[model samples]
Target: MSGKPKLYYFYGRGSMESIRWLLAAAGVEFEEEILETREQYEELLRDGALMFQQVPMVEIDGMKLSQTKAILQYIAAKYNLYGKDLKERALIDMYVGGTTDLMEIIMSYPFIQPEQKEGHLNTILLKAKNRYFPVYEKILRDHGEKYLVGNRFTWADVQLLEAILMVEEKCADILTNFPLLKVFQTRISDIPRIKAFLQPGSQRKPVPDEKYVQTVRTVLQMY
Candidate 1:
């Protein structure tokens, strides 16, 4: 709590990206320990820093946290971004849960086989248009609020903004049908903290390229 939270993950965005987004949205500046080699990760294992031997471990508030959901929930709660009540928190959880499912697909794209990359991209765009985007679009249409939950900028909004950008990276016009989401994306991106994070020289990671993929695979010892 005294010092800035320290994150342990690869140089590129993966499960750790959402954590970065949440912290940024909360206006919390943190440090990162990038794992560029297998030995660095194994050292964490050796020192018992990783709870489940995962890379997205965060050392914060005198605890070493792993598991993406747990870490996200803690940060959201601590930063007062979860919700004011249980019902609102439930909605945030639901919205974030759905968004996480969509992000997971994108996160795995780098490791996918070259032959299947086209099909994988098709799947991503398909789900974004048919399944995922519609859900948030409907929520915004019905809620008539600036954010998904409680009309306040919470973890759900941060996650959605991150997802929207990730999807748009694949297809620039993915939000053409979802006008509300396009507005939401622009509005959220303009928020002071998020706006700062969006600018150059922030902790935001770039889209995973071949070098990033190779580095991750090498560090994880994954063929």
Candidate 2:
């Protein structure tokens, strides 16, 4: 009800995760609004004031902005959550873009039959992870465990953790074989800020059940 910025998110959905994590990391307060049904979304859409072409839009002083990555960059810039230097911001963009690629792959599965998901895993997920994941591992390895950039927490780190956890929860075996990614993920999850965000009550909406998690995992791990 307050006039502060508001974020509209779906429970357990990808659109909201990174932004939610970033918001928590910045200690930037927000109003979390849930859209639990298509009807609700439709109603909002019908109103014609919602920003871009998706959920997880942020309303700042009643102005709406949409698209997950755009929202993220906006908030990061506004709150000084990105980093101090040009190189660090570039790295943040790289990792965040990588996450977007991963999400695209996962979203593609919705159109495939349950059985076909495995095929995607074998062809797409396998190739992508093998090629791209090591890049991320190397980043973490080079950063020396202080943070994604300059020994300071940035939106990039929050984005990485959320994307990694989404994979861990939905596709457990996807990156389990990567030592650095696994270790980095564990380390990120252990951060006090991130740990508190992962707590049950902090959730703005109910998480997907274990069965869905396993189902996603089973299909994604086919590679």
Candidate 3:
């Protein structure tokens, strides 16, 4: 609140990635306390910083917050990105909820076994094309609006753009059939704040590589 919000997570993108995107879109500069070892995670628990004993905890507005959705909602509201009215907020919530479903699958991708990677990738593409992408595409088509709700750029748009990039990382042609979403993605990415976040040397994290996966496993003792 007073100073920049500090994020607690691994160096890799996981649940914290959306928080990063939201903060960036809000034009908020934040700090990070990356966890590299199991001890660092335990210390947060020992210090009672993590209410649910989890990473992705954010120190913001004089409170230590955990739970991905709660933190995101707070940031969205604080930055006036939620929406103008309750109905618009509800629409944004529904759209964001759908995007989160797809993002959650991609979030777990790094931990997947080598042999299962292809199957998982297929699932991601399938869901993106058949289920997720179609919904947003239809929203834009029906509303003929630049954004998903109230024709205003809100948290839904931010989450949608993040989800689009996550899916594109799997297959570049993932949105070929979803023409409106293609335009939507371009429009959202071109926003000044969002564009800065997409540029090189920004806080945007790349797809998780072997080292990132191993580091996360080691920190969480997932082996």
lDDT score of residue 194 within candidate 1: 96
Quantify all predictions' global Cα lDDT against the true fold: 0.94, 0.69, 0.93
lDDT of 2 by residue, 65-140 (tens): 8877788888898889778878889978987888777766655554566788678756555644676677777877
Tell me the TM-score of each prediction against the true structure: 0.98, 0.78, 0.98
Deviation from native of the Cα of residue 104 in model 1, angstroms = 0.5
Off by over 4 Å in 1: none
Q: lDDT per residue, candidate 3, 80-133, as tens digits?
A: 999999998899889999999999999888889989999999999999999999
Model 3 C-alpha lDDT versus the unseen true structure: 0.93
lDDT of 2 at 12: 56
Give candidate 1's whole-model lDDT: 0.94
